[model samples]
Target: MEIVLKKGTFLVFLCVAILASAQISVKRLNDPAIVAQHKRMTFESWGDWRPYPKYFLGIQTNFAYATVWGMWAPKINRDYKDGDDIRPLKSTGEQNLRFAQLKFQEEEVKKIKAASDTIYKRSVQDLAHWTSATVDADPLWLLYYKRMLKPITEFPDNPQNFMEWRLKDQQTFETLNSTGTLKRLQEELDLIKEKYTWSRTMDMPRGKRFIMFHETLIRWRIFVQELRRYNNRTTLLLDYRSILNSHLPTALPTQWTPTSDKGIVQNVMQQYKHKY
Candidate 1:
């Protein structure tokens, strides 16, 4: 093949080829004082010479190759053990934060249970008063007064607690001096139902405590409801007495949740360490 080239282009190509093939050398600056002086001289006017493309490219290439060969290589993967997979422990600051959150949750549960206990006491007292007063005022009050009194006496709750339980039955109270025997009893039942409905609507905790609290509340309602009907209907007397037997023993069943003083702290540390 025939080729044509300008004289300047041919000369440039020859120089490049010679530079690539030859063992080139740079003569050191002869004056030791000049070299020493240059080391301290600021080159701010020319910006940074160390950041030149060639210098940076060489540095980056060396680093990339070193990283691959020394760290990311297959030999490193083979040498790694299961122990290496485990994470280190958490920092003191992070442990404190997790423990703080756990404490907050615990306090929240405490607050809820406290509030639930208050409502529970109020409801139980209200039913107790209604049962006690109605039994004493029944037309057949004398016949079974002693029989009904036996359960109330043996129950764990104090009669004094029922003193706080006032009349919430507006209909029964307004007609206290006028309503018929069965009519007053029915309205009183409505009052008991009102308290039961309120208890059912409450947002109680979801644990063993919840079951015990709800069951006791329900049994109290059943006992009271049976008492209201027993006077007019003798068949309900046995059911009324039976509910009392089941309720008295479990009158205040409390679930004791075991707690660890260091649990929150330990859990926080584990979570921060990625061990959780």
Candidate 2:
């Protein structure tokens, strides 16, 4: 196929070709600097050339791929036995994010029984090394409770970190309290739902941390996108007080006035004073 290039394109192409060939020649060449130079050429051409949307998408995709890549590696390499099959250490469930606390809870009964048995056997088998009989009565149950408390105490997070990644969510939520209708609040919720579904569930420490980071970033992106969209819409409001009040009712100062193009919507709540 015929191709076209802008001026200096031939030189650029030649440099890229050399870099591409460098990987294969690295062993024969026996010099790390040569490979580094080749890499420099390739990345130099692509310097700061990232398409952000695609870059982030690539990050998310790479994260997802790396998370699940183990499912596709060569089977068992059984002859050498380096321990590839993690399904055994794992429970017989869809291998997903390990909410370790929930997992500990699920196995809590077994754990509790085991703990109790250990205590009982210890007391029966040896007095000085054993815990008290009362403590031994159901030691596992106590252990399970101790383990379960950490994650459970974090439930329904009281709106502190709920919008941690979502600046727009917080903004919109605050906005709704002032000039927004309930519908607007619902819309903000929808914005959050659109992009931030957590898909990868593997619970490896490092990999899952990356997954969580990107997942949090996805929520932030959704928030910022919606915020910009909201900013672009006219007729939303220009009364700084109104806009701010919508999102931060409790933060209101007593003497603030609403001053939009339409002037002000009088406080009908005070004037209309419906009987309870």
* Runs with alpha carbons beyond 4 Å of true place in candidate 1: 1-179, 207-229, 232-276
Candidate 1, residues 31-120: lDDT per residue as tens digits?
A: 443343343242212112121122364454444334433333466523432113221122333445577878999999999999999999
- Reference-based lDDT, each prediction: 0.42, 0.43
Per-prediction CA RMSD (Å): 31.7, 41.2
lDDT of 2 by residue, 1-276 (tens): 235555468879888999889866876586543454344343232122111122364354343323322223345322212433333223432233355656877799888999999999876655422323332233542564324332222322233321532334444444433554435534554544332222122222333433443554555456456645554332254345566568843434534433343443454233335633
Point out where model 2 deviates above 4 Å: 1-205, 231-276
Give the Å shift of residue 138 in candidate 2. 37
Estimate the TM-score of every prediction.
0.22, 0.18
